[model samples]
Target: MSSNRLKILHWSDYACPFCVIGDKRLNEVLEECNIKDRVDFEMKAYQLDKDAPKKPHLKMEEVFAKKFGISIEGARDRVDRIAGIGRNEGLDIKFATVQFTNTFDAHRLTKYIASQGKDVEKFIDLTFKAYFSDNLNIADRNLLIDIAEKAGIDKKDASKILKGKEFSDEVRKDEEEASDKGIRSIPHYIVNGKYVISSSEKSEMKFVLEQVLKDEAEGKLNINE
Candidate 1:
């Protein structure tokens, strides 16, 4: 007699707009499945630009153009395409105003909040909203504390966690584990420790979750579908 719960591991970066869209779509799949209590969800750390400066000195447009060798207008058009997709999912991605900074500290704070048995998704949502929608700096300590408080995390506890390296190791561990799995992209989802899905399309994610549940209920032990 064993418990039949789906364990989902998601690796993402805060600076990646695609990860933001993917998170929202994944949530929709979970909600529609009506198995909130039957699933175990975990967000892991994977920095898209681990070497990024703590405080970025360039605008997002310039950063994009320089990184991809495109004109500023071309960068805007490219990001606008992703922003259009986000709008379809009821998200506001203000790419022009977003401050792209290192997300290592943010990941550490999220790890600490999740360890307290709190709803880590709430904090993750706040992080995305603060960065993508409000264009707030996610690396700011004060801002992180405020977001934590809004997510039901104690302000004092959050402040303390930010002041020290309490969850730094946990964040690093997640990155290392993901690297061991040969994961090279963000928003990667692993279901039941076997099935792997890379796309963030809402319909695809919903179909996979439903399929996993159906397979488990049918006593299928080797779930590769």
Candidate 2:
């Protein structure tokens, strides 16, 4: 429970399919090592589709098609493949029904939740399920508040955070830091502020956790490296 244990800065976007899968696998590794008690898990902000419009809400399939210059059907197939990967990680992904909303507000809410020192893993899970599985409009204030409340956060606090522009600067700062670090994708985990692991591979995730834990045990964590 010491503050000196390994700190993991996890950068992710809720809309990204790989992030959800990677998070689940990382949670499994943390559970196995009982590192939750010894490590600080911080969720960093990243926006995959920063210029996405707000109105005339775009379905994920169409969004993919436009982004990749593919047909809608092709996008559907690609999303199905991604959803299959999610299924392997035990996620109930309904890509067809997913609405692509700007996650700037959601990222702000996440930063606010982190400020309270609550379990951000649960918050991220709820947000992912709300958007990808439940097909809820995460950008909507009421929906965001409801999701936050369900994650054990106070409804009043959630309402206040969602209503105003609170934590917006903090979220933007995290996003800038991610850009400076050249993290171009989601599910990026930086351990001890040194080890960087991208992608959602279970084996790679486990290896990162083990390495961090070994460093903690041996007192040889090179933060500058």
Find the candidate with the highest TM-score and give its number.
Answer: 1
Could you tell me how far off, in angstroms, the CA of residue 151 lies in candidate 1 after the best superposition? Answer: 2.1
Candidate 2: segments with Cα more than 4 A from true spot: 1-4, 32-36, 222-225
**What is candidate 2's lDDT per residue for 1-225, written digit by digit as tens?**
335566788998878888888878887888887876666678898888777554427778888899999999999999899999888778898877787778888899889888887776788888998888998777787888887887778999998888888999998898899889988888899887788788788889888777776876787876443
lDDT of 1 at 192: 76
- Per-residue error (Å), model 1, residue 79: 1.0
**Inter-residue clash pairs, candidate 2:** none
lDDT of 1 at 125: 87
* Candidate 1: stretches off by over 4 Å: 1-3, 221-225
Question: How badly does each model clash, as a count of residue pairs?
Answer: 0, 0
TM-score of structure candidate 2: 0.89
Q: Score each candidate by Cα lDDT.
A: 0.85, 0.82
Question: Which tens-of-lDDT digit does each residue in 134-204 have in candidate 1?
Answer: 98888898999999998899999999999998988898899999889999887899997877778788877
Task: Give the clashing residue pairs of candidate 1, or none.
Answer: none
